[model samples]
Target: MSRAEVKQLIGVKDVARIVLGWGAFAALLILHPLLEPPVPAPVLVIALAVIVAVILVCAFGVVTQAEALAHRLGDPYGSLVLTLSIVLIEVILISAVMLGPGEHATIARDSVMAVAMIILNLVIGLALLLGGMRHRGMAHNRTGTSAYLSMLVVLVALAFGLPALIGVDGSYATAQEIPIIILTLVLYAFFLFRQMGAQAGDFTEVDTRSPQRSPREERTGIRQVLAAHRAEVIVRLALLVVTVIPIVLLSHDMAALLDDGLGRLGAPVALAGVLIAGIVFLPESITAVRAALGGEVQRVVNLCHGALVSTVGLTIPAVLVIGIATGQTVVLAESPANLLMLGVTLLLSVTTFAAKRVTAMHGAAHLVTFAIYVVVLFS
Candidate 1:
């Protein structure tokens, strides 16, 4: 075939592509059990490698569609959807893994810590590094960055520290945890309504990292698009939900397999924490790299930071509610690696904000930090 034909073939698609992509992945996960000890080591390795690659490709599609939907709706709340999607995946995996009979206090702790490192190193790291490199000297609404940082500090402290302080004293069954959970949800709701809703104008935080547009009165283009394409929107929404279910189920099983695999390989339990982090972050990592390359740094910031916030703000409440309702308590306690990662993340976040520009060097630094996280996490 001609080069053009090959390119066309590469882009070729219909429901069949989606089905094959999703179905093959689903089948691998289902049949993973059948690929037993009898299978040759080399063959099993190749098969597992192929499965991971396929899953990564599917993740790309999932993230791309999510980005498309967000663009169609415009950002802010649209970004919320993308962030929540990932957070839901994390919560599902974490909850599912924890459901198995072991002390998952470390799982909760490490998952949150893993997320913190991803946000600080990968997300904020790229943002500052690339934005600084491109702009050399960029400026943002310091107030905005500071405010976000402050909220982040409080949120992290509460989410991670509170469990140790409060302890699962069975008050989880009483009204005690209720008030705390309610307060947590209320704070998130306030920010959602204030920033993305009617009060958005009151907070003018320009992301110096991104390109600027005309300060004209905002238009309702997005609203019109969403209204006109209601049916398509509904279809996409339904597809998102449909896609999520299998991923969640597969992730749950994947976590289990990962645990067994780690034991077989003599891997640290922290490896499982890292895997949970990887599964949840697979989508955001793709989007972040793309946004940075596309020169949409502000969007990148919004996505990365916004995702961090949502993971803590949104996922915390949902998981807490689940735990409360199901008579399980999901608190933050675990391996020392969790605290180590958290400290690193917090320090990086503060440095990024204080010095509002990022360079390729900075990006490189963040990547190095990420490497450290991987080493420590795996060690």
Candidate 2:
């Protein structure tokens, strides 16, 4: 009955809701692969429904974690982690599927393009647009934004555009691609280290003016916080790993089934791309949507812009190397529709950010652009 007890009850209730939601989602995800049609047909439908539910739940968990993790790890890499996690999942799935010898090099190209187009058109575009609408020109350090965007352009151009323009013949041994791949990866690694380690401040909007604390001060502070919290960071990370592994397995199964199902159903092939994007982007998409609803444009800007940069700059290069090495070729060469989509995405992003600020009108404009993309894909 006491006030402290009352507050504790409310806190526990909120935590319960989150845990239950995620737990239910995890359950469905776990059950998805086990629900093969050797079982009754009606039962299979029920299982698919559960799979859908789990996807929604997992999406919720992703967005919730994004806010919390971003606070802890700092933007934009904190946000980068969300998108990166999804991209990593996709790469793992594609790599697994492409383990065979007959896989096309263009598989890598198509996937990269698919992911890029989805991220650019829907995830990044609308997040920024809606966030801009809410904030009416949310402020991000223009310098950092420009740098991130520029690097993204160059990386995508090199990875996707170059391959297309050159019309690389299958006759060229993948061994020839290895050196270029290594050089690109090494360059990326160098930039990553510099960005995260010594120059982390260069990417931030917040200016931390406090003098550097001693190692002891930092350690003591960390110790106190860890001591105060019952759950450790390691525990959360382990849970994330545990939860992620099953989801990844289930995602692979679902990807194969969905591909078959959509093809049999006479669904547009782009639906396959959309489904892939849905699984990979569930986390980032939910965050942007929630931020839009909440009228938090700055968070939206950080999520969308950061996701775009990470998808193209990091994901594309990583996959290019993986595809070449694994002989899967998940790059952008498979689908011309995907190439057109990527071009539209790049054009929209360049124009959207060219002003260095965004408005609600811009958000509406981007939504219209996204509508066109969907129409074109389905048509």
Q: Would you list the C-alpha lDDT of every candidate in the order shown?
A: 0.61, 0.57
Model 1 superposed RMSD (Cα):
5.6
User: Which candidate leads the pack in TM-score?
Assistant: 1
Native-vs-model 2 lDDT? Answer: 0.57
Q: Per-residue lDDT of 232-339 in model 1, one digit per residue for the tens?
A: 566555555545444444444555556656667888876776665666566676776666665555456667777777677765666666666566656564345656
RMSD of each: 5.6, 5.8
Q: Number of backbone collisions per candidate, in order?
A: 5, 11
RMSD of 2: 5.8
Candidate 1 wrong stretches, greater than 4 Å = 1-17, 29-32, 35-40, 93-106, 126-147, 166-176, 199-222, 228-232, 235-249, 334-337
Local lDDT at 112 for model 2: 61
Candidate that would win on lDDT: 1
lDDT of 2 by residue, 1-379 (tens): 4567545433443344356555755665676566553545466556556656655655555455556656665554555566566656666666655665565545555556555666566665566566666667754455555656666676666666666665364222365456656656676666666555554444555333656444354445545655654243333333343344444444445554566566666777766766666566666777866766565544555566556555555555555566666655444543465556666666766676667566666666666766676777677
> What value of lDDT does candidate 1 attain over all alpha carbons?
0.61
TM-score, cand. 1 vs. native? 0.78
